[model samples]
Structures are given as structure tokens and as C-alpha cells.
Target: MTEVLQDLAEYIEQKRSDCVISWGFTNGELNISVAPSNITSFVEFLRSDSRCKFSTLVDITGVDYPDRTKRFDVVYHLLSMYQNHRIRLKVSIRESEAIHSIVSVHPSANWFEREVFDMFGILFRDHPDLRRILTDYGFQGFPLRKDFPTTGYNEVRYDEVQKKVVYEPVSLTQEYRQFDFMSPWEGAEYIISDDEAEGSKLMDGSKGFKDTLTSEQKIRNFNINFGPQHPAAHGVLRLVLELDGEIVERCDPHIGLLHRGTEKLMESRTYLQNLPYFDRLDYVAPMNQEHAWCLAIEKLTKVNVPRRASLIRVLYSEIGRILNHLLNVTTQAMDVGALTPPLWGFEEREKLMVFYERACGARLHAAYFRPGGVHQDLPDDLLKDIANWAEEFPAVLQDIDELLTENRIFKQRNVDIGIVSEDDIQKFGFSGVMVRGSGLAWDLRRAQPYECYDEFDFKVPIGKNGDCYDRYLVRMEEMRQSLSIIKQAIQKLLDEPGDILARGKITPPKRAEMKGSMEALIHHFKLYTEGFHVPEGEIYACVEAPKGEFGVYLVSDGSNKPYRAKLRAPGYLHLQAMDHMASGHQLADVAAIIGTMDIVFGEIDR
Candidate 1:
């Protein structure tokens, strides 16, 4: 694979000599640095070339290197389905510059470019609908920029007299802390000074639809707010739908209400502390998110996981897969007027939550999956409980399968609704079940194979029709496959008895050992306060997260803290396709589409 990537990199350089600046491999993935002006042509070559069919646009994120000559780096992660290879393309530009948008080549670039503009104030030329994405409407500053204060410039609240949401200058005072740390991105010190903070306060210049259009023009297309409070909408997911009486003309999802800047927050904290933050993103499958972060760190540090820990991580990840699918498929059933599925499914979810609580002492946010391995090893009794659950879990799945698979009402609501064609797969940068639901068997576990996944034998489910029902069916089959994987991991866990965590500077000494030995105690103290430094490099690591491909684009400048940690959340892409999917459907079908896509605002807004 390494030689093939190198040869391909040389071929690319030889083919497009003007566009290519540098090409090399980082963490076994090919990375090409291209000129900002020629990135569109370079991307076109990579996508359309027969040998380099990098069709899927995985993610686009902006990395702010404040002190550098070129202040911002726009990164594009692309995956080649035909070749089973991935590439990262970068274009470095100054603060005032703009890059050509590749929406003409790959429609997936539309939302990705919008997010880059929203987070870092990076402009994209020729983007049809480029505007604020993961921020408040008319948001004052770019939150992800290095100069921006963590406590953003503007905030919104519901005033008593106004009775509607109102935006105002942020009132909170955050005292600066000077840590005397030099970050290439965050300038010479850890604390951002007031002058530097002022640089990030440029308000977005885009006008709202009502302000831009005349009353006569507005009457042709009626715009209505879908929610922040509507029972049908997902939590705080508000959309501006341009309706033509019964049919939706356009669906503009007004997200960012839950935007917490998880990536920016990761830069301030040590890698150890950052693991828990991933849990908050996809709270439905907390451990799976942690697994991706841990993998990135483990890959950078070159810390080898013990066989026992590898199996344990796989076990928990599969459990997360089942948890996410159950919540999505069941809630989707409820969205279409069935009440019984949620009732029956929640019972199974409770059973899984018990396993989480038993393992990590937290049912919801089990920050147990760490960089070296899990926080601890699973006991024999807990393994027995898991094994017991594995056997009995399928009966509940069978009951739900029987109830909804061929049910008259269930099929009518989902069968051909919210159809996503095979071409729509690459256009929306779909992954996990969303890609599978569209008849593409593209799974990171099988395609990329992280952790101990390569050792497991499992079948990837493919959907026949790319509709709401096909997605539901994919999730259902996925749960069963996950259950099979869990059982296999448990068998391997019972057989392999060794260190569950890695033994090195990366992994901490056990609490019992810390009390006995002075070396252990000192090592434990230093490990938590000032974490071990990772050798300088950048790596894009991903796991087949419950909803889709959850990735961490981690950059380390030889520091205990990450320079930048951009999370490539699958929900964000799924949410981006709402406009395309729901534009022709009725108003009520919006909820069904949202549920089928498994649109969790935790990861989406993060």
C-alpha cells in the first residue's frame, strides 16, 4: 500500500506539474499540497483519473496557523472507492484570500465549503449557497480561528418583553490565563490577548432571504420555520422551509444552536482530557467516538494495544453500533405514527446501557476508551453477562423485524420515501448505513479496517433501494452483525488474558501500583498534569461510528496538546442532504427523513 501510494503521488506530480507543490505520505495516507488557485484542477484530476478515482469527499476543514505566512490551511479528505485508497489535499491561503469551490465536480463540497466559511471565515469562490453553516444567523465572528475567544463575541437569548429570540453582544467576562506556551496556531502564548480577539469580530455580510427579496417576490415562495420547539423536529434542529402550499420548495436547515466548538476546545486541553469530549458529540454511541480519537492518538504515538484491549475496544464499539441503530430505527417508526417500536426498543437500549454502566460506571458518557486501550479490562462476570445478553438479544430484534419489515403501515411510510440514488451517495459524502442504504457496501471497518476489526468475520449489509425503509433495514441488519461481532470479541477476550492497557509512557500506572512504588506514583502524577508529548505530525484517523464515518484530523506540533483536532462528523453530511431529499417531499416527510438519516445534533452542531 505504501509503495502504491508513493507511485501514485509521483504520477500525480508528473501529470499536473503546475498544480502540485508537494506530495508525500503521512501516517500511511497520501497528502498533496496544491496551490489555492489550482486546487480545483488538481481535485478534478484526482477524481476523474482512472487510476485515482477519489470520488467521495470525506470532509473539508480549515486549520488556522495564525503566526504562519499563509494563515489558514483548507484541507480536503477524499476517498477512492474503486482503488480503496484515501488522499488529503491541502491549499494554504492568506486571511483575505479565497479558494475555488469544487461543487461543480463534487456536490458534497457545497456544505463542506459552507462549514469552512462558518468556522474560520475562509471564503469559497463560485459556491452557489455559501453562508454561515455551524453558527448563529448573522454570527459576529469565526469561532474556530485562533484569535477568537472561546467565549464567542455574540450570543442569543429569549427576552421577556420581546418574546422572541434576540441577539446581543456577549456579556460574560472570561479572565485570560497565561500559560507561557508557544503555539504556531495560537500565537506565542496560550492566552489570546484582547487585540488578537478583536481581529476575529468581523460579522458575516450575507443578508437573510426576507431582507434580500421584495414582498411581491417573497409571496411566490412562502418561508416558514420548522422548529427549535416543534415536537416533530429533532432537538433544536430548526429549518427554514420554502413551501408551495403542501410541497417543500426548499429546506434550509438552521443549525448551530448546539455548537460547542469541540475541536477548538480539544486544542486547549491535553489528549487524555480530549477523549471525553468525543463522547458528547455522538452521545448515542459515546464509546465509538472515543475510539476514533484514541486511534488517532495511538497512531501518532505508535503505541501498540494489547490483544485483550483490542478485543475489548471492538466489543464496546459493536455495542455502540447496536445502540445507535436501535434508537434511529425505532424513533423512525414512531415518526411515521407507530408507538410500539420505541417502547420495545428502549427496553433493549436499557439492557445495553447497563453494560456500559458496568464497564465504566457511566451509562451515558463512558470515557473509558483511552489512547493506549480502554480505561480497564472487563471482568469475567461482566463478560458472562455480555455473553448472556448476546444470546437473548436476537429474539427482540426478531420481534421488531417481524413487526415492521412487512407491516402494511410501516412499508407505506418508508418504502419509496426519501430515496437516495447511488449517485447521491458520493454527492452527499455518505458513509456507514447511509452509503449502505444507497446500495453501496462502503464500510470503514471492512474497507479501511481499524483496530482488531480485520480479525473478525462479518457480513456487510447492502440495501436494495435507497429509501427510508432500505436505511431502516440496513440498520436492522447492522445490529445483528454487531451482535455477532460482540460475541466473537467476547470469545477472544475470554481466551486472551494479558495487559488490557499498553505498557509505556502513554499509559498510566495502575492505582494499586502507584501507591506501592515511588516511580509509579511520580509517573502517574506527571502523566495527568503535563501529558506526554507526541512527535510532530498530522494524521486523519476514522472509525465506522454508529451513524457514519467519525474521523479525527489531528495535528500535533510536538506538544502535549493538539495544534488542531477537526472532527469529521458523519451526521453533518447527512444533515447537509436534507435540502436535496426533502425539497420535493411533503412537510411531514421531513421528520421521517431526519430520523432515517439518524441526525443527532450532538455531532452535527459540534
Candidate 2:
């Protein structure tokens, strides 16, 4: 691993010596530090270079160091699908300095750069349309900064007089009280009710009611708020749609309503404590997200996961894929007025959630997948049940297919509503069904080959037309492929029976052993209390989550808590292209587009 990185490092330095200043490998992942001024040229070189084709700009983030001369470290993570390598590029700049934007190199970096600007207050020069991407419009301080207060700058409230939401300084010390020194309607030009008139002759021409009417109202195309509350929104996803009668002209997506500051929050929490947060991101298909973070930490520490544990991870990840797809497929059916699919799909979904409960005790936010392995191994009985469930699952899928695949209404609604071409897919950083629906035979499970996925035989489902229907078909087929992987994983789990965790200080000692031995007790004490310290380095690990590619970029700084943690949510990127997808389509198609995008707020709000 070191030797290959050395060759690549040598190649990059030799080829672009003016840009490359220094480079190193941390746990086999290459990290290159370059001059901020040459970022555009350097990134373009990476995308175009034969030996160093880091085509996919996976994520862009900034790490804040309060005391340093260069207070911000703008980091870029890239992946080479063709070369099969990942690299991190770092550029340090002062708080006031703006770095050159790489949007010209990778258009995927648009939202990511805006997010960086929003979170860290880091500026990007020449970004096409840079603004606050995640935070509210009038958001105060950069929430992710080290110095920003947890309580936040202002208390938000609706000002009735102004007829708008306003931000005011929070009075934390005072007990919550409203001091109404003046009447709410003191200055308003409205006639008080007869009860408040305080006069007997109130009806006798005492200026009872003032009529304020105007005929100057002009009509035009309207800007509509689709949802911060509507059902088809999936969760608090609000789109400000500019409409020309029934057709959509522009869609401005306003996110961060549900933002808990996952990245900023992770910086203060321990590795173990932070694992549950990933589950919270993609709530439906949680384990797949946990799998990504687990792989990241494991890669940073260079820990080996046990074969049995790897199989269990694979099995559940496939389950998550089905779980997410079922909800999306059914709800997408519901979006088009067909209510039967969700009812039919969720019946199969409940059984899968039962499997989750059996494995981790929590059905939804199952923080089961740890760094070295899963929290515990699945029992033989559960495995048998899964094997049995796998056989029955196909009938449910086929029944759903009969309902929607050929149904005229469903077909008409989704057939060409949200057509995404291959160019748009690559340009917008689409993944999962978004990528596959565009006819790209690219699945991270196949291209990246994480865990034991390569050993399993499964087909990658690709779509031809790149429309909503094609995306649906890809997901339906992917669910079947997931079942195949799950079945194969069950067999592998039976064959490779061994320790469910890595054998080292990383994995906690068994409870039984802790009671018997002093060394075991010490191991348990340190692990539970302090948590293990990861090696001081940075790694961006991703899993082909059901939605798309959900990634975690971790900067350890050799601490119990991460120095910086940035989540690359595929939904965040996919949703950014909502305007691209919805323009020229009707208002009704908005629901279909959002549904087929398979958006869940858990990740986007982060």
C-alpha cells in the first residue's frame, strides 16, 4: 500500500511540482498538501492525469483551528474510479483569505463549497452562485466554528406586526416571559369589537368599521412554498417553487430547518458516542451509513474486521437497502395517487425492521456496527428466519411490480416526469438509483468493493431512459439483488464462524471475562469511559447507501473526539439539483420528482 502510494506521490510531484508541496500516506490513504493558489490547476490535473485520475470530487470541508495563523484547513477528498484510489488534498489559509474554487473542475463541489462557506465562514473565489447553502438566510455566526456558542446567537420568532420571522438576541438568564407593555393591536387600523368599545351608542356612526380596499393588485407567475410541512416532502424539505400557472419555472430548496449540526456536534463527542449520529442521518437505512463510518475509523486505525462480522455487516446492509427502497418505491407509488403499494410494501418492511430489532435491540437507529465489527453477532435462529424471509420477500416485490410496473396511472405519472440524462448525473454527483437510472453501471459495492461485497455475486441494475420510471425500476431490481447478496451472506456467515470482533485492545473484552480477570476489567473500563484514540490522520470513507453515497470525512488529530467531522450526504447533493429536475414540469410533478429522488431529511438536515 505504501509502495503504490509512494509511486503515485512521486508521479504527482514529478508531473506537477509547482502545485504539490508535500504528500504522505496515512493508513494507506494518500494526503497531499498543496498551495491554495494553484487549487484549480491541481484539481484539473488530478481529473485529467492518466496515472492520477481522481475524477470524483467526493467532499469538500474546512477544519477550524482557533489559535493557528492559518485558522482554516480546507480539505478536498477525491476518488479515482478508473484508477481505484482515493486522495485528500489540503490547503491552509487565514480566516480572511478566500481559496480558489474548484467548481470549474468538479461541478459536484458547488453545494459542498457553499456548505463550507456556510459552516466555517470560509470563502471560495469565483464560485458560480455561492451563498448560505445549509443555514438559514439570516443565520448569525458560523455554527461549526470552534468559538461559536452552542446556544446560538439569536432566538427566532414570528413578528406579527412585521408579518415575518425575526431573529432576536436570546435572553438565556431571564425566565421566559413576554412583557406586553403595549397592546398588540395598538397602532393597527382596525375597529375594536363592540365589547371593547366602552360606549352605549357604538353602533350610531362612531367609526365602527373602516373599509380598506384597493384595486391595484396585479397578477403574475407566482413563487410557491411547496413544503416545510407537506406530507410528500418526506421530512421538513421545503422547496420554494416559482410557478407559471401550473408549470414549475424555478425551484429554490431551503434546507437546515432540522439541522442539529451533526458535523459540529461530532467534533465534541467520542467515536462510540458519534456512531449513533450516523444512524440518525439516514434513519430508514441506518446500518449502511454506520457501515461507512465504521470502515473509516477501521481504515484510520488499520484494524481488521473478523470475517463473520463482515458477513453480518453485509447481510444487514442489504436489508437496509431493501428497507429504504421499499419505503421509497411504495411512497413514490403513493405520490402518484396509488395508495396500495405502501400498504403492500410496508408489510415486508415490518419483517425487516424485526430483523434489525433482533440484531441491535433498536429497530430504527441501530448503532450496531462499530469500528472493528458489529456490537454483537446474529444468532443462528435469526439467520434461519432471514433465509426463510428472503424466499417470501420476492412475492411481495412481484405483487408491487404488478401494481405499479404496468399500471397506466403510475406509468404516466413517473415515466418522463423527472428525466435525468447521464451528463447531468455526472455533473450533479448523482449516485445509487440516480446514477443507475442514468444507465451508469456504477455501484460502489462493485467499483469500490468494500468489505466482503466483492466475494458475493450480484448484478448491477442500470436504467436506459434516466427518468423517474427508470429510477423506480432500478430500485426494484436492486432490492432483488440485495436479497441475493443477503442470501449469499447468510451462507458465508455459517461457513466463517469465528470471533465477531477484531482481536485487540480496540474491541472491548467480553462481560464474562471482565468479571473474571483484572486485565479484562481494565480493558472494559478504558473502552467504555475514554473510548479508543484513532491514529492522527484524515480519511473520507463512504458506503453506497440506499439513497446514494453517504460518506464521513474524519480528522482524528490523535484524540478521543474528532478534531473535525464532515458528513457528505448524497441527498444534500441530489436535492441541490431539484431546480434542474423540476423546471418546466407541472406543480403536481414536484411531488413525483421529490419522491423518486428518495429524499429523507435525516441526512439533509445534518
> Which candidate's lDDT is highest?
1
Q: What stretches of model 2 exceed 4 Å from their correct place?
A: 1-11, 48-53, 151-219
Worst 10 residues of 2 by lDDT: 173-182
**What is the RMSD, in Å, between candidate 2 and the native fold over all Cα?**
9.7
**Cα error, candidate 2, residue 23 (Å):** 2.6
Tens digit per residue, CA lDDT, model 2, 1-606: 578878999999999999998998766678899999999999999988888877777788889888899999999888775677778899999989999999998888888898888888888999998888676544656777777745554768899999999988875432222333344456545566777554424323333443357544333455668888999899998888877778999998888888887887888788988999988898989898899889988999999998899989999999999999999999989988998888988888999999999999998989999989989988899999999999998999989998889999889999888899867875677878898998888889998888988999999999999999999999999999999999999988877688888967678987788789999889888887898898898777888999998888888899888988888888887898899999999999999999989988889888
RMSD of 1: 10.3
Question: What's model 1's lDDT at 128?
Answer: 97
Q: Candidate 1: TM-score?
A: 0.88
- Deviating ranges (above 4 Å) for candidate 1: 151-221
The clash number for model 2 is: 0
* Pairs of residues clashing in candidate 1: none
Go through the candidates in order and give each one's C-alpha lDDT.
0.86, 0.86
